[model samples]
Target: MKRIPLLSTAFIFLWFSTTAQDTLTLSRGQCEAIFLRENLSLIAGQLNIPMAEAEVKQASLWPNPQFTLDEINLWATRHQTGGKEVSPPIIGNWGRNQQYAVSLEQLIYTAGKRKKLMALQGVGVEKAQQYFNDLLRNLKLELRRQITELQYLQLSEQTFQTQLQSVNDLLSAYERQLEKGNIAAMQVTRLQSKQFELQKELHELKQQNNETQKELKQLLHLPPQTFLKLSSEQFERALTDETIPTYQALVSKASTNRPDYQLALLEKSYFEKSYFYERALRTPDITVNGRYDRNGSTMLNFVGFGASIDLPLFNKNQGNIRKAELGIQQAKMLSQQVLHNVETEVAASYKSLLNAHAFQKGIDPKYLQRLDHSLDAHTRNFLSKNINMLEYLDFLESYQQNKLSILDAARDLNNAVEEVNYASGTELIP
Candidate 1:
C-alpha cells in the first residue's frame, strides 16, 4: 500500500514530462516552408551555382605576363667589364658596376581560344544551375512524400487509440463481472486476450509513428525535443477531383519543367562547346617578349622585341579533339534515353494515381459513419448480455479491420498523388 503512492507519483511525473514537450502543430504547407528554409542539403546545393559562376569569371581572365631577370653580376670582375658604362646609374656607382638582363613576355592566344574556352565555361554555369534545380526537385518530392506518410501514420494511430480505449473499457467491465461471478473465467480471459492484442497493435503503430516523426524532424530541421503534430485541416480534401493531364501534355511539361531533362540538354551543349574549344587548341599561342640588357647583348643598353610560338610539327591536340567529338555523340544518346524514361514515368504514375483515386472513391463516407454507430451499439448490447461473446468479439474485429482498410486506402491515394507530382516534376495533382 505504501508503494502505491510512489508509483502514482512516478506515473504523474512521466505524464507531465511527456506532455510538457513543446508541441508544434503545423500544416503540410508550413512544414514545406520550414524545410525549404532550413534543410541543410538545399543550403549546400545553393553554393554550387556561385562556385560555377566563379569558374566562368576565372576562364574570362587573361594570363599574367612573365618577367625574367638574368645574368646579374652584383660585383664587377675585371673580365666582365668589357663594355663602357653606358647603362643608367642606380645609386651612382652601383649601376655602373652591375650587369643584368630583363625581359617581359605576354602569351597571346591564337584561333580565338580564349573566347572559346570562356564559352565552354559559360555552359558549365548553366549546367550548375540546372543541377541545383534538379536537387530541389528531388528533395521536394521526398519532403512531400514523408509528409503524406506521417499524415497516414497519425491517422492510423488515432484509430488504434480509439479502439484500444474501447477494449480497455470493456476489459474493466468484464473484470467487475468476474468478481461478481456474473461471467465465467474463460470469458474474462478472452476479453483479456483481446485487450492484449489491442495493446500490441497500438504499440506497433506508435513505434512506426515515432520513426516517421524522427525523419520529419530531421527533414524540417526541428529541435530533437520538439514534438510535432500535423494539423488535420483538409487532410482528405477532394484529391480525386483534380484532373490529370494527357500523356502528351505531361510529356511536354516534363520537357519544359523537369530539371534532370534540362540538365541532360545542357550536358549536350557543354560537349558541343567543348568540341569547338578543343579544335581551337590546335593553334599554338604566341609568346611576345620585350628585353633590355646591360653589357649582355651586341651593344650596351640593348633593347629588343621578339615573339615565339610552338611549331605544329608533332602534336596538334588530335587526341582531345577526338575525345570531345565522342562526348558529343554520347551526350546526345543519353539525352534521348532520359526523355524516354520521363515519358514512361509519367505514364506509370498517371495510371497508378487513377487506380488509387478509384479505390478511395469506392469507400463511401456514410458507410464509415454507419460502421462507427454500429460499433457503439454492439458494445452496449454485449455489456447488457443481449449479444453473446462470439458476436461481440466478431463485431469488434470487423470494426478494427474496416477502419484499417479505410486508412490504408487514404494512405495509398495520398502516396499515389505524390508519385504523380514526383514523376511530372510539377505539382500537377495539387
Candidate 2:
C-alpha cells in the first residue's frame, strides 16, 4: 500500500491559524520585556526605589531654623506695659511706639548623629533596590515556568487532536460497516468510547491551557481578550554538556548576585547604624538662639545670644539604644540564615538541572521523527483493514505515551534550567 502523508500536522497548523482572537506570538525575551514594562506588580515594586531615594534626600537635609516673635504690642498702654518706655527709639516710628521681640533658634546635631542617620537611610535605599531586584527574580522565574507549561500543554494538545481525528474517522467508517452488518456492534461501541475518552482528555488539556494562558497574559499585561502563543523557536532547545560549576563557586556567585542575600547584609548594616544613631541620641542636641528686643530688655533694641540643651537627667534614649543592639543581633542571625539557605538552594537546583539535562540528552530527535512516521503507517494499515481495531488502538495509546513523555521531559528540562537561574539569582542557564 502506498504511504499516506501526515494530515494531522496540517490540521494542527490550521487549528491555530483559525483561532478566534488575534494571536500574539511572543518569544521569551518579548514576554519578559512586556512583563517589566507593564506588569502592575513590577510597576509598583519600581516605585519603592524612588521612595527610598526620597528618604535619602530627606535625611541629607538639615533641620529648619525656627523663628519666633513674642511680646508684641499692637496698641501701647501704660498699665499693660507695667511702666512707660524709658528709652528713645530710632529708625523712625518702627521702634518708637511698637514693642516686639524676635528670636531664631537652630538645632545643632552632636556626635555626628545627623550624618550617621543619613548613612542609615542610605542603606535603606540600597535595601529597597535589592528588594526590587529580588521581586523581579521571583516573578521572572514564575513567568518562565508558566511559559514552559503552556508550551508543553500546546504540544500535548497537538498529540491528542491528531489521535482524536484518527479515532473519529475510524468511528465513522465502523458505523457505516455496522449499518451494512459487516462489523460487530461491539466494535462500533468501542470506537465511540475511545472517541469520548479522547474528547475528555482534550477538554482537560484545553482547561489547563486556559489557566496557563490567563496567567501568562497577566504577566505580559496583555488584554484579557487577546490570545497569546509562544514562537516555535527554541521550544526544544538543547543544552551543551558544559562543565557545571563547583558547589563552592556557585555559592560564591549566589552570594554576590542574589539580591535577597545582599538585602540581608544591608539589613545588618542598617541595624548596626541604627545602634550608633541611638547611642548618639544619648547626647542631646543644642538649640542656639539669637534674639533682638524692643523695650523688653534692660536696654532698648538689645541683641543677645543663648544656647539650650536637654540635661539628660532622665530618658536618655537607653531603651532605644538597647533595642537597636538587639536588632543588630537579630539581623546578624537572619543574614547568616539567608546565606545558608542560598547555598543549599543553589546546590539543590544545580543538581536538579544536571539530572534534567542528562535525561533530555537521551531523547534522540531522529528517533522521535521515526516514531511519527510509524504512527502514520500504522494508522494507514488500520484503515485498510490490514491491522485489527485492538492492535491499532494499542499502538495509538503507546504512541501517545511516548510523545507525551518526550514533551514532559522537555518541559522538565526547561523548568529545571529556570530553577537554576532562579536559585543562583542570575541567568546561569541561558
User: Residue 230 of candidate 1: its Cα lDDT?
Assistant: 86
RMSD of each: 8.1, 8.0
**Residue lDDT tens for model 1, 302-357:** 89999999998989999999999999999999999999999899999889888888
* Model 1 spans with C-alpha error above 4 angstroms: 1-19, 82-91
Candidate 2 lDDT over residue span 227-279, tens digit each = 77776556675687774556677788899999989988998899899999998
lDDT of the candidates, in the order given: 0.82, 0.84
Clashing pairs in 1: none
* Predicted structure with the largest lDDT when compared to the true one: 2
Q: How well does model 2 score by local distance difference test?
A: 0.84
lDDT of residue 60 for candidate 1: 80
